[model samples]
Target: MTSTADIGLGTAELTKIFTTATRIKVCDEKFRSLILTGQVSAQYYSPRGQEIVSASMGAALRESDYMVTTYRGLHDQLAKGVPLRELWAEFFGRATGTCKGKGGPMHITHPASGLMVTTGIVGSGLPIANGLALASQLQGTDRVTVVNFGDGATNIGAFHEACNLAALWKLPVVFLCHNNRYAEHTSFEDGTSVDRVADRAAAYKMRGVRVDGNDPVAMHTAAREAVARARAGEGPTLLEAMTFRFFGHQMSDQNEYMKPGELESERANDPVLRFRAALIEQRVLTEPEIEAIEAQAKSDVKDAFEFAEASPLPELSELLTDVYEEV
Candidate 1:
């Protein structure tokens, strides 16, 4: 991650973005606790090292802009302003969740926030984002659609197809590839053909760039340009943001596939901690103020869990509802 001092952002805006990033980081930590402590029976994809990507992107986005993400989208969800209580309820399988507890962690959808869809299928989000962009274009709105997915999803056929169509139609969309270098235990070299995922953008005739995903400044700059291009009717931009995940693909992953000392090395350069330190160094915030943010994040998480605990589970009556429909 790079320093925020050179990012040209105001102190107030810089702290706000970093604060949300920190809050999301803490939320994921608490969630890992829930999974390991057996408080919840569900699968979760941790965004430990990659919070900066979503954090910067979220900060750059508007409420009216659309976002489509894959199953491993909890970080993206929280970054897009999904309420803690609603997200926690979704994880806890309560009726008050974004999808009324049925979507669990994978299929959460909240149109009110413009988080249009969270698909379990890899690479599918690209086309969905394109459709949202199309809607915005037809309606003559400058709203840009941001789609986030893993590096592995880029190998899927839908990825190429969507990119091609987006470029062809000049759709207002940005493709943010969360390249953690691992696609469910497989290395990028083993799965992807190109050395850099950004290189593939040329095939679709779209602007592409690679950035240090763990760096707030870099990620924000890349996302800002991409959003601006999309909003100006210049078409989509593929941002291949590179970073690593501290944990394995899922909670149950034993991480036997990782090389020794690899995880330690990555964790040493923790993005959230780096950003906080940068903020302090820039005098944008003080240590005490940051600590207070951390304390509030903990309290917020606690309250969210409490609200989730008190919320109702999906009822039998709703089992058949939001499922098959009758005209």
Candidate 2:
């Protein structure tokens, strides 16, 4: 029952959130099209239902803040301001990519936008984010680091180690668990002992919050509070964002594991569409304005895809170039 006024976000902020969510949705649609058309042959994870979680979180941060995300991180990368052209080039394995076509979608690293690491390993980003936060603390910089992981990652040993260290040292890090209920093929009830992931934060004496990830206002408010706390030297916060992925774990997954009507129900409640309607109802944006925003996103994604297709692949000499650095 959170109203617009209670959300504490103005018209501009709401519009920004809607715009970001629309961009992510358009990019995702374009990506799936590429896969279906056989234009790209890489592993893909569709962030179909969890757009608002990343979009709102991204809107809460500054350009200088650091972020670490998982392999299923296209949404995270796009929301964090990774250039659409370079991102598409990387997907297409072109030399103009963030990693010069080496990393592909799983390992997108754009330091300029403070998206430092896109790790393929589960639970690995937590410790890396801690290291970045520690450096910021030692250097007396107020930079906050945000680490995004799935609910399954909470079971990893690194999760406990990172949380303990962050709390013990009061590091400026935010542990964001995109709890979509299912961990790969396993459901949360089957894999996790605890009902709520945020409840575990008590073991390390850190603040814990659980919010609806599909709601832009709720997600943004939680993220803003966590980021502000970290920046103000208040220490780390475990913010568990509850969401659901509309697609399966990977591109090839048929979602056979999902219960009857589960997928259909979630699709009917798509967050992107929900937010669009909310904005229009609040008078923050009109239907035509929203349509214009969507058109821009579509055009931008089309241009990026074309640019990627026209870009050249990495040279053979590149195999040995980034292997070792000179002293």
Candidate 3:
């Protein structure tokens, strides 16, 4: 067992994680703005506070590994090296999108880049990840598949069926549940009686671990171990990241159910800000360095917005294409 003192978190890497989280925050804001302005036609769900989980996990992944994410998955795509402009174009329903404009915001996919596909249906990607893992196993490759979903997904019947199948086959898959406190406006407790989604792993007889989703260091360590185990012929693992989503479930939500001071307290633990402060205190990066990184990220995001606005929409003839292979 690796000792807590021996955890390899240098100052430089921690600072990078912090800035990445900040970039995610900015992305969410921009996505929401585009939706409100009628530039985008979908409901925008911002993973505002839970950015650390996706960023840390994405960083830990090898280039060849595959990842399947949910509709609220901008962070995962960004982490997986998908260009911001392309993602923005997808949201804008332009030709330059990862899916050539038809996939839209929720249905992002980049198979060549190791992202199998992102689905809008809650809990639907779990079995797809299992299939990917099975394919990798048969091909004798060490490619692990990671599926990311929210707390709402955990309550669905598909979640149970997928977990059972993955464990039964001993597939090399990691099921990551972002327990973001609420499923839309419904609290987790109200949605389900389970205290921790990871607890359900017991039914599948798989290894289960819960980590503080806000802490990038913790997430990185957990993902590293889990991915390593999967590659080393171990079966699946269920990782529940206890996190909070700062924004409403969608752009249309008024978030009136959130109690007084709840959001304020959650904002106090903003992962990006907290991680930045930790990096500075640990002598990893200076304030000036942090500011420089933020400036660059903002500029890149701005450029992406411009690119999306200028890009043309998908051609009319292409609509029926990519749906099925040519005979």
Candidate 4:
């Protein structure tokens, strides 16, 4: 794996992104608790150590720009400035949810907040993002459409078709691929031949890059560049962020497939910790500042959970009615 040392982001900013990583950890711990306690039945993929890529990507976007996220989309939404109360409500299937309790955990839509919609299908969001970009391009708008997917998604037909059309039309889209080395227990080496997902960008004749997904500053800088290029009508860009998932593919997976010591190894190199270390090393932030950020994130998340627990589920009368419009 390539180190983040070569990426084009400032150490101080990268530290901010990484050091402020407790939100993701809080999410992970809460997710596990949810699963263990049977609060949620669906599968959960915790991007424990891979928070930098999604969070930084979200941080780089403008309010007008749109986003299409994947199943593992909580981080993306939170990073994009979605309110904790709304996010928790959505996860809890409450009327206050971004999708009004229709989309659940895997499906979240906050159009007003620029989150178009999140799909349950792995690579399905790519084509939707392409369409969004096409709409923007045809209408002569400068708004950029960004899409997020996992390493496993690259091999899917939806991903291929979306990229092909986006490149053909010179759409303003940035395809962010989070290569976490595994596609639900299946390692990348077992799945395909390509050493790096970014290398596949060459086949489309579009700009392709491989960056350390754990480095938030690097991700932010890269996303800025890609968005800039897209807005300038230079065409789409493919960014493959090399990251690692600290948890099993989903909540149910035994994760026996994970090599021994992998968890320990990744923990040592965690983006959040490393980023914090970098900040202190550079004298940009002190220990108290880092602790304050973490404490706030935790307090915020705790409040969200409490709100979600208190929020009522959708009523039966409304559920049967929202499926179709009477008019």
- Evaluated with lDDT, which candidate comes out highest? 2
In order, candidate lDDTs are 0.89, 0.92, 0.85, 0.81
lDDT of candidate 4 over 107-208, digit per residue (tens): 878877788888878899999999899899889889999999998899999888888888888999999998988897788888867988888888888889
TM-score of each: 0.97, 0.98, 0.95, 0.92
Off by over 4 Å in 1: 1-5
31-82 in candidate 2: lDDT tens per residue? 9887989878988888889999999999999999999999889889988999
lDDT of each residue in 217-295, candidate 1, tens digit only: 8888888999999999998999999999988999889778888988889999898898888888878789999999999
Candidates sorted on TM-score, descending: 2, 1, 3, 4
How do the candidates rank by lDDT, highest first? 2, 1, 3, 4
Residues 1-327, candidate 3: write the lDDT tens digits. Answer: 112246877655566567677788888887787778886677567888888998888877887899999889888888777788888888888999999999987899987668889998988999999999999999999999999999889988999999998899889999999988888799888898789898999998999999998888888889888898888888999999988888788877877887788888998878778877776676677889888988888888999999998999999999988889989
In model 2, the number of clashes is 0
Per-residue error for 299 in candidate 2, Å, reads 0.5
* lDDT score at residue 24, model 4, on the 0-100 scale: 72
Pull out the clashing pairs in model 2.
none
